[model samples]
Target: MPLGILEDNKLEHVPGTAPLNELGRLDLEIGQAIDRNILKHDSTGQIVLVPQPSDSPNDPYNWSRWKKELFTVVIAYGCGCVGAVGPLLTPAFVPLAEQFGVPLQRFTLGCNGSCIVAIAASSIFCNTLAVKIGKRPIYLATTLGLAVSCFWAAEVHSFGSLAGARTLQGFCMAPFEALIPASIADIWFVHERGFRAAIFNLGVLGGINLAGPIAGSVIQYGSYRIAMHGMGGAFVLMLLMVIFLMPESAYHRKGALNIDTGDKVIVTDKLSEASIEKSGVQEVKTSTTSIPSTEPPKSWTQELLPWSGYFDHVSFWRTLLRPFVVIASPVVMWATLLFTTCISWLVLISITLSQIFAAPPYNFSVSSVGATNVSSFVASLIGTLAAGPIIDGVVKMMSKRNRGIFEPEFRLPVMITYIVFTATGFFAWGESLYEQQPWPVPVIVCMGLINLGIQLGTSSVVTYVCDSHREQSAECFAIMNFIKNMFAFGLTFYVNDWILEQGVRNCFFVIGGITIGCALLTIPMYIWGKRARSFVFRYKLLDRVLKAP
Candidate 1:
C-alpha cells in the first residue's frame, strides 16, 4: 500500500476526527494520488485541495492569489470596522453619561448591552439569510445599515435614542461575526484557512483596541457627538469599499466532497451517475450532475449585482436549528467556554479602561486613556502575524510525524502560549493598578501581554473548531458568537458592581484564577477530544435534530 492510503477506509468516525484515512487526516506525503482528476498544487503535488474545486472559473477556490488576498483584506477591514462599533464610544462614555442624565452603569448597559444582545439575536437570522441568498448582498446591506445607525447615534438626544441606534448597529454588525468564518471555509482550503481566519480575528480585535484611541482623540478636543460623526464617516467609506472591491464568494460546484467519513469522493457528472453512502445513514439516491455552464467569466459590472444564485439545497429553518443543535456537541461547548472566557477579559478591559485611567492616581485625559489601547493593538498585531503561520507549520510538522495523519488536537498546544500570557498578564495588571503604578506599567507591558494572549487564544479556538467540524463550522460559530457575547452581556450586568464591591486588586486576583481554570481545560480536550467527536457522531446527536422536520 502507498504511504498515504489507509489499509481499510473507515466510515465509523465523525467528520474531522476520524482515524487513519478520513476527513481530518490528509495524505500530504509526496506522490500519493487522491484521485486522477482532483486538483493539486502545481508547486507541490504532495497536497490536494480538500473539498476539491470544480473546473468553473468563478469558484472562489480557483481565484488568483492576488484576487483572494484583496477579497480577504476587504472582508477583514469591514469586519473590523463593524466590530469596533460595539466600543466606538467607550472613551466618551462618561461625557455621554453626563449629557444623557444617567449613571455610567445604566449608560453602559443601554449602549453596550443592547449592542451585544442584538449581535447575538441577529446571528440567527443573518446567518440563515446569508446562506439562503448569498453573503454579498447581506454585506452591502449591513454596511449601509451600520453607517445609518452611526449617523443616528451622532444625532441622538436621549438615552433611549442612543440605545436604539446601538441596537441597530448590533444588527448590522452581526453578519461579520457569524459569517466570516464560513466565508473563509468557502474560499480557502484547510491549509490556508488558519492564516485567513487569524487575519479576520485580528481585524476584529485590532479595530476594537484602536477604536478607543481614535474616539478619545476626537472627544478630547471635541464632543461625544463629534466622535460619533467621525465613526459614521469611517463606515461610509467602508460601504463604498464593499460596493466596488468585494465580490460574491458563494459557489455551487458540480461535485460534493463527503466530509463525514471520507470513504469516497462523490464527483458528479451529467454523463455518469454517482451515489454517496453516508455513515449509518440512508444512501444518497443516484443522480446525474447538472451540465456545466459555458457562460463567460463575469465582468466587474455583473459582479456588482447583489444576488448570487440561491443555494436551493440549504434549508433556512434547518440551518437555523444547527446553532442550537451543535450545543450538544462537547467539542463545540468547550470551544465556546474557552472563547468566551478569553473574550470576556478583553471586553472587561475595554469597558473598565476609561474608569480606571481617567480617575485619581492616573488622572489622565480622555486622549491619554485612549492612547493606552495602542499597547494592546501592537501586542495583538504581533500575535496575529506569528500565530497563523506557526499554526499551519505546526500542523504540517505534527501530521508528518504521525505518518501524514492530522488530528485537530494538533492545534491545542498553541493554547499553552495563551495560558502563560493571560494568567501572568492578569496578575501583573491587577498589581500595577492596585499600587497606582505609572500608566506605562499596566497600560503598556501588562495590557500588551493580555492582548497577546487573547490573540493566540482566539486563533486557536477558531481554527480548531473549524478544522474539527469542517461541515458545520458556520453553525458552530453561530452558537459560539451567541454564547460568548451573551456571557459578556451577563458580566456587564454585574461587572461594575462586582468590581466596586471587591476592589480592583481582589477582582483581578479572582479573574486571574478563573482564567487559569479555563485555560487548564485544554488538557482534557486534547486527550479525549477524538472520543468526544466519535461519541457525537455515533449517537447521531446533531443529526437527529438537524434532520428532524
Candidate 2:
C-alpha cells in the first residue's frame, strides 16, 4: 500500500465538521486514498500536501530541500537587516538628541515613529506590486533603495535628513513583513511551515535584538555615523545576495482550484482515473479540471534573471484593494490584534530600555543599554528553536486525536504559553524597573520572558493565518502588517509621555492586562473559528469585493 493509503480503506467522518470548501477547514490527515502521484504527499504519507506542487521543477515547492533552505536564509538575512535598521540608532538616542538639540520624545518621533508610519503606508503598494509583477525585482529594488538610505543616514547633518533616510529605509523594509510569509507558504507545505515560519521570524527578532549590541558597541567606541556606514555596507552585501542568489518565488498557480474532498484532501488539477479505480475510490467530487504542468524547467541563467514576466492575469487595482476586503475576515482581525499586541511589546520594550536604564537608579552606559538586547536575542533563539519543531508535532498529535482531520484551530493551544509568558514578563518587567531590583531582573530575566512570548505569539499567528486563508495569505498579511505597524507608529507619539505620566509600573500593568485579554481571544477563536470561516465563505464576502468596481 502507498504511504498515505490505509489498508482498511475506511473513511471516517467526524461529526459537526464543516464543509471541506469552508475557508479554514483544512483536512490534513493520514490514511487518505488520494492518489499520491496526482496530489503531492509528505514522506510519511501522514498528510496530503496543501497547494500541491506542479511537475515543473521551477516551482519553488519542487526545489531541493537544501536549495529552499538556502533561499530562506538569504531572505531571512534581509529581514534581519531590515529589522536591525530601525533600532541601530536606538542606542544612540540620547547622544543623537543632544547633538540635534532636541528632546528625546521629539527625536524618537522623527526617527522611529516616522519610520514605522512609512512601513505601514508602503506595505499595501509594495505587496500589490509583488503579487502583480514578481517578488524578485521588488526584493532587489527595495534592498538597493534601503542600502542607499543607510548611506544617506550616515551623512545626515540634520534631524530632518536622518528622518528622511529612516523613512526611506522603512518603505524598503515593508515588503518583508507581507512577502516573506507568502513566500514561505509558497515553498513549504502546511505541516512544514510551522518551523520554517519560525526560522523567518527568528531572523527578524534576531536582527532586531542583536543590532542593539552592535550599535551600542559601535556608538560607545566610535560614533553613530560609523554604525550607519556599517549598516549600509551590510545592506550592500544583502543586495548582492538578492541579485546573485535569490530566484523569483511568485509563480501563479493558474487554474488551480483547491476542491476540498470530504477528507479535506485537495483534488488538484487532474485525478488519475486508473489509480482511483485501483484504490476502489468512489464519489470523487471536483468542479474543475486538473491538469499537470509539463513546461520545461527554467535554466540556471534564466532563473537568475531579476524580473520574471508580468503576472498580467492579476489585476493591479484588485490586488491593491484586496487587503482592505480581507481585513473584514474575523481571523485576520484577531491575528492583527494578537500579532500587533505581541510584536509591539518588543518595540515598546526596545524603545524604552535605553530610557529606563540610562536614567536614575540603573544609570547604565549607552553600550550597556544596547548590551541588554543580548538577553532578548538569546531568549528569542531558545523560544524559536523550542517552539518551531514542536508546533508541527503538536499539530500532528492533535490531528491524530481528531481521526486525522486537521483544523486551523489546532494551532491555538500554543497561545496559552504566549499568555503566561507575556503577562508575567510585562508585570515582572515593570515591577523590576520600578523597584530598582537589579539589572539582571528586568534586563535578563524579564526581557527574556517577553521575547519568548513574542516568538511564540508571532510565529503561531502568522502560521495560523496562512493555513486558514491560504489563497489570500498575501492580502491578509499585507493588511495585518499595515494595522500592526500603524498601531506601533501611533504608540510612539505617546509612549514616552505615557510612561512619564503613568509611571513604568502602572503602564506595564495596563499593558500586561491587555496582553492577557488579547491572548484569551484564542479561546473564542478556537471554538467558533470554523463556523465563522464557513459563514464568510457562504456569504461570498471576498467574491463580492473582488468583483466590485
Candidate 3:
C-alpha cells in the first residue's frame, strides 16, 4: 500500500493484493507520490468565506444616506429634549414654588439637583452600559423613560413626587448626553466626526435654548400639563424615529458567522467598506480577524456599576485622584479649564439675561424670559455650523505641516477670534443693561455673543479632549461633563442671588473678568500643548490620558 494515493474523494494509501519487498515498495511509493502531486486539492476547497464587509450595507455606516441623517436627527432631537427641557423649566420656578409651598430656592434645587445627579452618574455609567448592552437600545430606553417621567411629573401633586419624577427623568436623560456622542463616534470616521459632532452639539444646544420659547408658548397658550404633554409627544416622535430608522452602527454590532462551519468570529466591520459601500460605492475586500478582549468580561452587577473596574485598579484610583493631571498637561488642563470657565460665564450671562429681561427694566413676564432663549438657539446654530468644517480644516492644515502629526491645540486659533467677539458681546450686554438699552441691542450683541462664546468654548473643549486622549475620549469626556455640570449646577443655583446682591453692573463686570481670564489661559495651552504631549508620552504618563469607550 502507498499512502499518497487519492481514493473515494479522500487521500488514502493505495491497496494491492499482497505485501511487497523493499524495491517493490519503493516503486509503489514513487508512483503514488506522482499521482498525489498531480491531483492535489484542499479537502475543504476555497471555503467561500464571504465575510460581512466592515462597511457592509447591513452596517450602520453603509446604511442609506437617509438612515444616517435620520439617526443623527433622532439622536440630536432626543438629546436636545433631555438637556433643554429641564433647564427651561426654570422659568416656571415661581409657580412651582407657590404650588409646592416651598421657596424659590428649593424649587431651583429640584432642577439643579437633577443636573448634579446627571453629571455624576452619566460620566460613570454611560460608557460602561454602552459597552455592555449597546448604544441604540440604551438611547431608546432612556428617551422613552424620560417621556414617561415627564408625564408623571405633570400628574404629580406633591413636591416629593415631582422631585422624584424629575430625578428619574434626569437619570434617564443622562444616557442621551453620554450615548449620542458614542453613537456619532460609532458611525462617523475621524475625518467626518467633527462635522457630525457639530450637528449633534447643535441639536443639544438648540434644543436646550429653544426649550425656553417652546415652554413659553406652552405657558402662554396652554397649561403646564399641556406643555409637558407636548414634550412627551416630541419624545415619542423621537423614539419612533430611533426604532424605525436608526440602524445599529457597525461599531456595536456583534460579529457575523463563519461561512464554513457557521461559527462566530470576532471582527469589526471596516468603516469605509461598511458605510461607504452601502451608498453604492465600490470598496476593497478586507480580511477579517478576531477581536481580542482587552478588559475582562464583566458580570451583571459589575456591568451596572460605572466605576466597577476602577475599584480594583489602583491606577484608576490614582487617575481619579489626579483629574488635575489633565490640567497639568498644559493642553488638556488649559483647554478644559478655559472652556469650563467660558461655559460658566456664558451660563452666568444667560441667568443674568433672564432676570434682567423679566424684572424691573424690561418688565417681561416669565414666558418672555423663556422666549428670549431663542437668541441662544440661533447663535448656537451659526456657531455649530461654522465650527465643524473650520475646526477640521485647521486640524488638517496643521497636521500636514507637522508631517501628519495631529495635536489638539490646532483648534485654539478659532477660539481667539471667538473670545474677542465674546468679550465684546459681554461688555456690550453689560452696558446695555446699565443704560437700560433697547431690547434689540441686548438681543443682538449681548445674547448673541454669550451664545457664540458658548458654542466656541464647548466645541473646542470637546474636540480637544477627544484628540488629546484618543483611547479614553469617552472617559475623558465623562470627566469633563462631570466638571462642567458641577460648575453649571452651582452657578445656576447662585447666579440669581449674586445678581440680586451685587446688582447687574458688578455682576456683568465680574463675569467679563472671569471670561477674559479664562480666554487668556488658552494662550499658554495652545503654545505648549504639543510639547506637553511629547513629555507625557516619554514619561509613559500617557496612561493618565482618559480612555475612550
Question: Best candidate per lDDT, number?
Answer: 2
Segments in model 1 whose C-alpha atoms lie over 4 Å from true places = 1-14, 17-39, 256-296, 313-315, 547-549
TM-scores of all predicted structures: 0.89, 0.90, 0.72
Q: On a 0 to 1 TM-score scale, where does candidate 2 land against the true structure?
A: 0.90
If the candidates were sorted by their TM-score against the true structure, best first, what order would they fall in? Answer: 2, 1, 3
Question: Which has the better lDDT: candidate 1, or candidate 2?
Answer: 2
RMSD of each: 4.8, 5.4, 17.0
For every model shown, the clashing-pair count is 0, 2, 16
Each model's lDDT: 0.76, 0.78, 0.58
Of candidates 3 and 1, the better by lDDT: 1
Predicted model with the maximum TM-score: 2
Error of 1 at 258 (Å): 4.1
lDDT of 3 by residue, 1-549 (tens): 011111121212111111111211232422322221211112342111122223233444444567577778777777688767666566566665786898766677675566556655665565555544456556667778877988887788888887887777777766666556656655553444566767767877787788877786677567677777778888888777667656554243334321111111111234222422232422222332323223333333433332322222234444453343444455555655765676556555544544577677787776887777788788888888888778777765654454333345666676775677777777777778878888888876677877776676667766665555543455455555667667877876777788788777777777777777788876766665555555554454535433321
**lDDT, model 1:** 0.76
